[model samples]
Target: MDFPQRKIIHVDMDAFYASVEQHDHPELRGKPVCVGGGKYGVVAAASYEARKFGIRSAMPGKLALEKCPELIVIKPRFQRYKEISQQIRQIFHEYTDLVEPLSLDEAYLDVTENKKGIESANQIAREIRETIFEETGLTASAGISVNKFLAKVASDYNKPNGQKTIHPIQILEFMEELPIEKFYGIGKVTANKMHQMHIFKGSDLKKKSLEELVRIFGKSGNYYYHVVRGIHRSEVKPHRIQKSVGVEETYWENLLDEESVFKQLKLISEDLEERLRRKEIRGKSLTLKIKYRDFSVYTRSKTQEMYYENLEDFYKTAKKLWELRPFDKPVRLLGLSLSNLNTQEKKQVSVQLKIPFPELD
Candidate 1:
């Protein structure tokens, strides 16, 4: 008998961080909400209400406040969010060992042969969503399809408590109208360039010769061509020895003091530390990036034999980097990254039975 084709499901939580914020703080429900540090901090999350006012996550708190003065800013409660994340992850694990977490609020599940043994990934996705809602009192959207790329797009087809599935037979029609912006790895810059090339949709992308696309846009255009053909193989990788994790900050005003640099390093540490804990990954190496007022840049890194889990260790390393670099100009940006990963938690992952090769030309 022929082995069954792969079945993939993508789950994305709607405005995850912001929704969590609103859920806990009942008074803030239905109001324009943006989670960030106070006046001097960065945006950590933006509610749908705040998003309508042109506010977004990673935007400066000051600018977001300007956009919506009424915007309610909530300081990040990472521990709470991480707790909720664990609640969500537990739900995915029940379905298969092949769940690949993209972030706290999103994941890809490979269930070709699953605990449910359901023929339709769409049915599995629905059950998963129903279970998550029953257990967590929160909602999630899912997309089901044969491959990772198509599954991801289908999940976003409906948002905020919805589900969408694209059967193999419907793949061609789906690709024909697939918006360029909706394509994975295609950002605002690529979308504008695609428009310039008269490629508004997959049909337009189909008109271009692969060689012509390659000549203009390099390796990405080659991938775009495959996507246009409704044939892209974006794998769903699990927590597989992450090579790097880092945080960068853009300062409101140029900093001339060592204290200022350390302060931002502290802030980034606090921000990234939460992510590290959620992913259950740690680092044995630290990298510091510096950008000067004139846009000059430098990077310095140090590694210890042992993994670091506390803020004190990260701060000491970052402070040492600041002291060693000794820049003459004011600093406009500071970033902290942890690399040389492969921490203890990574060893716990299970190896899956590999599938045979695809018939790619």
Candidate 2:
């Protein structure tokens, strides 16, 4: 019933984009700040001061302004963020090379065999957070636990310059008391579905049989079944392969007519072609993603008979897919991605077992 405890740490930067702006500009410090377009675009990142006014990333800027009249909206400086992110990453490499970046602001690190030979994961997390702040002037929160899922969940427990460690002894009690929505990877829709099934918390989810869960959630039911019992076996893959290449843009104004939509698609197609060519990869499948003004998304995909690497071919297929689907609302975002790429190689993952309840405890 017992297994080796692997130390995993999830490091999440606090308000990365907004914090960079605030750190660079002293005048913006201690004020409600967000990084994104003003007036029409969505908030890319909201500072803690802005978060106090219920402003959050991806919220429409108009709504964010209404919530905080004095909010300062700034355009994102991506290159600046990247520079800071690289500095923080160097700090991570000092401790462990088994680092998997989730984004510019977050990463998973397996410090079980860290270069520093530190024995305690909690101490490593503390040092990492402190070093990130000292070097980048940006605060980070970290979670340390026996596995990725638990470590990711624990990281959020303490926010903006805080850290938490979930020991093996606390895993069962922690999962039991956790809300279903609090479980990492369970999105809003899935959480709502679980609510309808009376699976409000981990304890409630634990009562469902594997058959019942699989019947309701399909293959994901198996995932939920295992993760809820602290059985997430997925490792920190440092060199995860790129599954798809795509580009998307959000408009300040909605495209109400098909002509405008097509123009945007053409531009996106051009970008996708350049991206694919730059990577020296070709794909058999192309996807068109449309996000309506109401924030609902719809996608259509086409698989060509042969791999394609040029704009002309993919654009034709994208346009064909667009003509096939009927739009229900004005469009705000459009994107194109190439998949089933020639660069991809098939790899099989081992099936995880359903461990007994006693194993986690």
Candidate 3:
């Protein structure tokens, strides 16, 4: 059976948060800048100038300054970021309704049947990039291909302010030459595991049988097989509601005791509650995720009949799960997530707030 060819484009904003800062503050442009909480907190975004000094997002602000003493640190303005993101999304909607946003800074667009009646996907990508820069004074990179996976990978091939198109004929050569680390969804640990298995590149991955890949990598083996063949069937979804909202932190020092664990959970619970309040949503299910020092992960979850929307309730559930789980080793990471969300809506008035229309016969 033959599937219809698709024209998918992946657009990624270049250093979104940092770029926004530079765009807003002329003095910060062309200088090393880091947007984050503070010296004690983690770096949320780093400008390209800072990246040259090895400063990166998620690095501690103190460490970033050490790497580049001239680095100018600024607090994140999430509301401003969201506003810019909405503007970028509006630009995406001009061409295609089929847009799947990966985050505020990037998205996948299915443009096989676009509103502009454009025949060339490459030309469409160029136009989109040009328009974004013109309207927002920001640069974006685009990758065009027949599927989501390839398009995403292609988008990163050219760094800030560039675009790449992988034609159908070029897919095979592209896949074969691609490094294992370059593939999406393959993290550092997974890449290392693949290296130990003598799978250093896409060419090596394609040589493995499906059964062998599954036995080695579990369910994800099937995904790896298909993506290497340039066959990703995931569709672009425009109105994608989040299934869960969660936050996690990797400690500078491993958490060794139950007291420390609970203290951290309490803080995380507060953060989650604030997030829920901001989103105006509640959840029936709560989950606790713990990662040991060696990178092994474990999760415990509970689902309630009624929705919960407070910090106390979340803390209670998470604490119970933590106490029940074995903790022979120190913990490197901790997270709390709420799923099965319920968004609060205004109730309809029983009595007419205004004059009602006359009943029809």
Candidate 4:
């Protein structure tokens, strides 16, 4: 069977949070700037200039300053970022409704049959990038391809206000030359394992048979096999409803005691509360995830009849769940998530099973 080709575009704002900071404060442009938590806090985003000093998101702010003495740190203003994100999203809707937002700064758009009747996806991407700069005073990079995976990879090829198109005819050639580390979902740990197995590039990954890959990587092997062949069947879904909202932190040092763990939980709960308020969402179930130093994982959850909306409520429930778990080992990661979401959307049910032979029986 033959599959219809799709026109997928991935738009990623270059250094989104940091860029917004620069756009708002002209003095910060062309200088190293980190936008996120303050000194002794976690770095949320780093500008391209700061990146020159090896600063990155999630890095501790104190260390970031050590790397660049003149680095300017600014707290995140998520409300302002959300406002700009909405504006960019409106522009995407003008062309196609098939937009899947990955974050406040990036989204995937399927324009195979766009409202504008434009034939070239590349032209559409260019126009979108230009319009974003003109309207929002911020620049975005775009990747155009036949699938989301390829489009996302292409978008990163040219950083900071550039675009690239991977034509259907060039897909195989492009994939062959791409590095294994560059594939979406392939992280440091997985890349290290791949290297140990002598799979260092897309061509090397493609050399492995589907059976070999499955035997090596389990169910994810099938995903790797298809993606290496330039086949990704995922759709660009619009209005994707989130089922959970959560926050996690990986401490630089192990959290050895209950007191330290509780402190981290309080911080996480506060962050989750702010995020929930931004989305106007609440959940009836709370879950706690703990990762040990050995990388082992465990989770605990509790469900309540009442919706939780505040930090105190989330912390109380999460604390109870945490206290119930055994913590003989030091913890490397801690996370709290709320599920059973209340989105206010009308819920519907569909049939799950059917027996066509019931009459004959």
Candidate 5:
């Protein structure tokens, strides 16, 4: 039997941790404050106020302090954040059980068959946003799209109490002007590479043939092509324990050959594979990690549409990755892992297996 058209919603709390701080501490409201940085560390969360002053998460405490000398820095209160996350999760459960959390501050919900029987998924998202604001006093942005890729992208189209819905027909147009740098998997390095190739926006990326993109970008290019075409086939699955599981090993000697690297990585992969079997888990993403003679490190990963369960599968994925080393240095350490999980979720794997993308591939 054919199923009803699905509705997926991506919700992100506005500056979640920092916003929470502002909500509880009246003194912090409307002022620049960072929710991390106690003695010597990094910023975990930056208020919009802090962002305005060039302060951001992961900026060194020293640099963040320099950016905004008046920045009010506070240690993270995980208990409070967890409590709030549970509260928001409760809100999500009120509508659908097919909820996947990206982190403490973000989640994706599949409500095609919601308890509320709402015909319009956008309306459900809107109602959830209103409930969150009234009950939790926090603002969230919602993105609604035909698939997870577009839904995630739509969510970011607006922020801080905003919502964006992209119908399937509108998906292609919506991505045309999107900056390459802003694409979820494209990071600073890849964006620079794409810029050098005269691909600055999604339109530019779309202009390239999939084969050409594969020549330049390898496996990720296929996803890039599909994303621009708005043909992403990933789903919105129920929340689970882990999407990724991994193990790493460090060696005293810096090995210089591909054979040695693969051999060592094989050992790591074996343990990981056994664990995966024991847990009855499967994954689409595989990562091969390496540390070079100069102590520089790089990781390459590949995610297939299907999850893998065999050791040979992981080894092949790893070997392919090892062959793709563009800059080879003596290997100092190596590791392996399987991720993109859907633990006990009893739902189809979504495009989320598409993430953890920065690895060496």
Candidate 6:
């Protein structure tokens, strides 16, 4: 099957949260820093300096401290991060409106027919990176390729502040040498499973027949079979509708009692409320996620007839659900999410035309 050629560029901010903290506080530029709470909380974002000591996001703060005693921890300023993210998104609009945001710190852009009518996706990526640095004083890395998957993988090849282009002619050779673990959708668990099967790299994965892959990994195996052959068909959706909105946290210390548990829930509810209000979003269903000290997870959901979007309403329902939760084990994590959002999908305009590619150097 032949598909129309497309130009995709994945742009990822370098050490986003930590870089933002450093940019705002020049004194911390060269020092090892992370945006997270101390001792009891987890590392949210570790700067390259802290990464030198093997510190990473989601690592327990105590462990991070053990690795680097001089690591500076800063509280996350989400509002400030959002402000800067908006500024960056504006810059993307200048080149293309077909931008699919993966997160506040990264996005995939389809510039096959960009607003600027730029033919070279590599040039678009380079200009975007330079503009991001100039306007926000933050570095971004970009990957330009014929598809989103290749572009996503290429973006990460050069870190902090660099760009990599995966030309169409280089696709097969590139995929063959790439590690299975480095594939965008392949998680650690899946990668380990593939390793046990001696499928350690893209070359090894490509050896498996479609029937064999589907039999082992189910529907996802189909995705694996196609992507490994340099055949990813998913388009970059500019107006991807979100189905749910959530906020979760793993506490440094376990919530040993109902009072502590409810207290944490209240805090989480407040945060969720602010997020919903910021986006002016409401949902018909609320879900409460609980993780015990033993790491066992459970969820309880309640649906209301009418859509609600207030902290009081969210907390009141969440408190009731907690009261009836099973097994009163010390809670390790608590989360609240609103699903069945009142989001209407916008009409999509599709362009199906083969595009010319630039020659690789």
Model 6: how far residue 69 lies from native, Å: 2.1
Regions more than 4 Å wrong, model 4: 1-3, 37-39, 246-282, 287-300, 305-337, 342-361
Preferred candidate (TM-score higher): 1 or 6: 6
Clashing pairs in 6: none
Candidate 5, 1-361: lDDT as tens digits: 1122468899989989999999998899999999865334567889999999888776766788888888998767877997998899899999998887777888889988899989999999999999988888889999997777677878988887899998866666778988887777777888899999999998999999989988888888888887777766666656335667777655544576767877876777787888787767788888988776555778999989998777788887888898887645676557787778657574543222323333532
lDDT of 3 by residue, 1-361 (tens): 1234899999999999999999999999999998882555578889999999998887867788889988998877877998998899899999998887777899889999999999999999999999999999999999999988888899998979999999998898899889999888888888999999999999999999999988988878888888888888877766534567787876756799989999999999999999878767788999999988666889999999999769999999998999887779998679999888763342321110110111111
- Candidate 5's displacement at residue 154, Å, is 1.2
For candidate 5, which ten residues in a row score worst on lDDT? Answer: 349-358
Q: How do the residues 81-184 of candidate 4 rate in per-residue lDDT, one tens digit apiece?
A: 98999999999999998887778889889999999999999999999999999998999999999988889999999998999999988988888889998988
Model 3 clashing residue pairs (backbone): none
TM-score of each: 0.78, 0.80, 0.75, 0.78, 0.69, 0.85
Which is the leading candidate under TM-score?
Answer: 6
Model 3 alpha-carbon miss at residue 267, Å: 13
Please give, for residues 1-361, the per-residue lDDT of candidate 6 as tens digits. Answer: 2444899999999999999999999999999998884776678899999999999988878889999999998988877998999899999999988887777898888999989888899999999999999999999999988888889899999997999998888888999889998888887788899999999899999999999999998878888888888888788776545678888877767788888888888899999999887776789999999987666788999999999668889899999998786546788789999988876642432212221111111
lDDT of 1 by residue, 139-191 (tens): 89999887877787898888878999888778878888998888877778888
What are the Cα lDDT values of the candidates? 0.78, 0.84, 0.85, 0.85, 0.79, 0.85
User: What C-alpha RMSD separates each model from the true structure?
Assistant: 5.9, 5.4, 10.5, 8.1, 9.7, 5.8
170 Cα displacement, candidate 4 (Å): 0.2
Q: If both were scored by lDDT, which would come out higher, candidate 2 or candidate 5?
A: 2
Superposed by TM-score, candidate 4 places the C-alpha of residue 303 at a distance from the truth, in angstroms, of: 1.4
144 Cα displacement, candidate 3 (Å):
0.3
Candidate 5, which segments miss by more than 4 Å at Cα? 1-5, 239-361
Model 1 residue runs over 4 Å out of place are 1-4, 245-285, 289-299, 303-316, 325-336, 341-361
* 3 versus 6: better TM-score goes to: 6
